[model samples]
Target: MATVGDQLLNPESGWQRIDDANKNIIYNGNWISATGDPNTYAGTAHYFTLSGATTNSIEFYFYGTKLRIIDMYWSNRVNNVTVELDGVISSYNPNNSTNKYRVIVFERLNLQYGFHKVKLTTTSTSNNFSLDAIDIDSNGEITAPPLSKFLISSEDKHYSITNEYKDNAIPAMTSNTSPNGIVDASSFYTTFYPWKAFDRIIDPNGWVTNINVLTGWLSYEFDSPKTISAYSVQAGTTPVGRSPKNWTFEGWNGVSWIVLDNKSNQSAFAGSEYRLYTFDNKVAYKKYRINVTANQGAGDFLAIGDLGMYELDKYISSVDTSEVSFIKHGMDKGMVIDLEDEFIERRSVVKENSPLGLGKVFKQKIDTVKTPIKKASIT
Candidate 1:
């Protein structure tokens, strides 16, 4: 009777699992991303290959002493996986009569603590091969060549919008809308302002455009330039058809708006569904915008529950310690303008200090405000 942690299959502790979606792994083949298997998988997603002729393989560069390869074990899945670590090869057969998800098909331990490459290849891919996730030593990390250009989200100083819908003729702050935070949008419906999308709320009340305003945009301006590589959009409550179907994520130079990513004819979203889109963006930009052109057959308006931008992972193996030190030195010298002062002047500020170690203390400050910029209708 082999238990979950028996036979050194799955580690019971001291292991960190990295999802298949992590950019560190290089997948070679037409690997399809899928979910909703009969049994739950790691991160509820897996990448499966369809081609039997092609040399389907996946390579993970890691710095660790132990590793575990997780995959799907199911009936009719006839494939032989060969895992090559530092030129040493080992084989495993995941084909089983019973269905199981997140099965540790391969495990290796007590390796030299240094950089290593693990290449998993399907030698006899009579059917298909599925990769769920990989587990590594708790102290080790996925090590790869550092990316020169990536995008990241930093605190911005300003936001703007173009239009907003109001139910009554009076112009005053409502209980539903915040009067503080810098946000701007091209258009919005009653009580649903652009800042609502950035408020970190997952409720029904979100940013909505005026009726029939198909083409609109929401822009943000940062105090300094930032490299952003990914963005996410969360669906609002009910009538998901109102979500943006066609849109261009753009960054603004001094002269023009450069399209970073363009999506069209997107499927309708489910309520509060969060979707992430990643693209290659190396250059830093001071301004960014989401210009939407169409909705998912919602003839009345466009709505979004939330939106967010992200930067590349600043992993220790991927980041230069000297560069981080230089940035910190510049900040300590006041070479980079601190937006905290201006932010605190306009809103409530909270500060805290905690002791880190003997004769060492850490300080943190938080500023909260809600303010919006100019708005204009796009007819």
Candidate 2:
């Protein structure tokens, strides 16, 4: 049969031992073996004493979500011991009349994930303090999934301009065109030709098609397929019949243009706010095309200020919550102590080293008890 000490030291058994002999496990005084009798200890010998002074203490560092303190219990000459977890102090009194060995003195579970420190100090010198071992729950490390990339239409660099309103001073269907057509050139009524609706600009002075074109379209291409859930389009200065009224949003899934959203009879007021649209189902594609079939007014012209697309936000659905119980020694609960100063940040640096062209990840503090929200999703 495996001895109690054997079980406490076994990694497979989910118990980690911190004893007097460990160099990292601080001990302020001399080590002494138990004497004077009918011992209740479970190992080679019963109780062993590690002499403690009023100021004597043992401190150690650990990384986990839960911690448990184990110590030897004797009724005869035991004194009160103080325990601190991450600087929060709680006292334990091992003054029971019965002679119990290898008892749990204190335990704290469900702590935030990260590195932690624990300290045990003797408050009274009348009797010596006995520390047999300290056992920690084995499963405490956090395993986070790889971070994802944030996708937005602004990041795209390629597009296919269909009906560009060309001007002698300004380029036609170029990304440089302001989505709102608000550039300096737009101040002149005759020269106020904006680039094209697909140029990603919202400048009020930007492009607009000649009044009365039966049908028109603009296509955008990205380096990789992206998942889009919502889109918005700003109307140009001419919000009358020149604005698009009926249109279809399509995506190229490497095969054909798949219709994502079909809007009809849409209205746009000249110099009014942008019109926004959301898709019921999200789809992934490398190319997106907007086909305008009808204009708001009888005129065939179509005016678009700017256009944009965005992906949905992601979140963690679940996390691991396995529990590991600690073997009781003599650690007590409910002894009040003053709270220590809160931990302060020593420095700030990038959380991860991502690929040169890929996006980066930022560090954030989170509550383990609540579900965490993530801005992006992995492809």
Candidate 3:
């Protein structure tokens, strides 16, 4: 008899709460935090409030089987709330004639047990919206996985980028570029150097290209070869039009840059908005970069608040057993076996039997040789 709103009625076990002000949640647009009645809201403190706006949204990622959004239902509140769970869209209206607190605005149950991303947006243009808290099922303890180490972090010496803007004429406020190629862009605007994109801070004054720079490139060099399967890009504080609209994700494979993922005509980003893109990639490389070919009609410049590249856990999909062979003893006939698994990469020449004839044999390079070799009898 589990209830959605107000866990007091039928408290469900293993369901933990995530407050509105949690650092893991990303709030876009003008979201204000205000104090609310302890009895009315789930928590005793503050809740997020938004008034009279559309295109405003909030995103949260959780690892659980069920999710509950604790909001409010009132006359002035938002009439339409659009929920996007792992890219699937749904909508609900929380507008009611009477005030109702601790209401369950949206909930998804029995979801595939894994990590999920949910985005709640205000679809109604001219109404208010409130987010009290969020609840998710837990196994041992309710703990969201911490942000993984990025292959393009500013703290690590192993990670690096191209270069930063260096022009005395422009007079930068502070240059955070590194000589070891930590951060750099094709072009930058004064204080808005390229390093800010990898700084992990979502601010308006992030990495910005020069005005009228329609195309730009940002590259990263790793200390060792890294296999990246996913990446994320966050928009700056304002002017979403400055975001890159079309781009190609490339990796350097000792010779030339190979395109890992290509995107075209992407949707415009919201202020401080974040987006994650994943692709199929197995090869590891020491260098990776992004080549931006177009921007979202930002004839002035392009901007990026943050950039993160991630290497996911690798798993063996299939095993190759064709190269493996088994030799049985006590047989009437002797077989000449040159197992590739045992004799490869030795860097030495090995003399093995050949099917050409008894007088003829072939030589191959292998690391180890079978001791006490005997002549094979060919019938």
**Tens-digit lDDT string for candidate 3 (264-359):** 866567677666666767688877778899987877888887777776542111211111100111111122222221122111122442222212
On a 0 to 1 TM-score scale, where does candidate 3 land against the true structure?
A: 0.42
Better candidate by TM-score, 2 or 3: 3
What is the Cα-based lDDT of residue 170 in candidate 2? 21
lDDT of 1 by residue, 1-379 (tens): 1222223334445577877777888888777777665454444554564545557788888876677877767775656778899889888888876577777777775564555778888666477677777888676787553222121112432121111112211112222233432467898887788777777777774788887786688766655687776777888887788788899999889999999999886655767867666676767887778899987777788888877777653211111223332222111111112221111112211233232222222333333344432321211
Alpha carbon lDDT of each predicted model: 0.62, 0.49, 0.61
Q: State residue 120's C-alpha deviation in candidate 2, in Å.
A: 60
Candidate 3 clash pair list? 161-181, 161-182, 163-184, 346-366, 346-367
Residue runs of model 2 more than 4 Å from their true location after superposition: 1-195, 198-200, 204-207, 298-300, 316-379
For every model shown, the clashing-pair count is 24, 34, 5
Q: Where is model 1 poorest over a 10-residue stretch in terms of lDDT?
A: 161-170
- Model 3 per-residue lDDT at 115: 59
Candidate 1's C-alpha lDDT?
0.62
Per-model TM values vs. the true structure: 0.40, 0.33, 0.42
Best by TM-score: 3
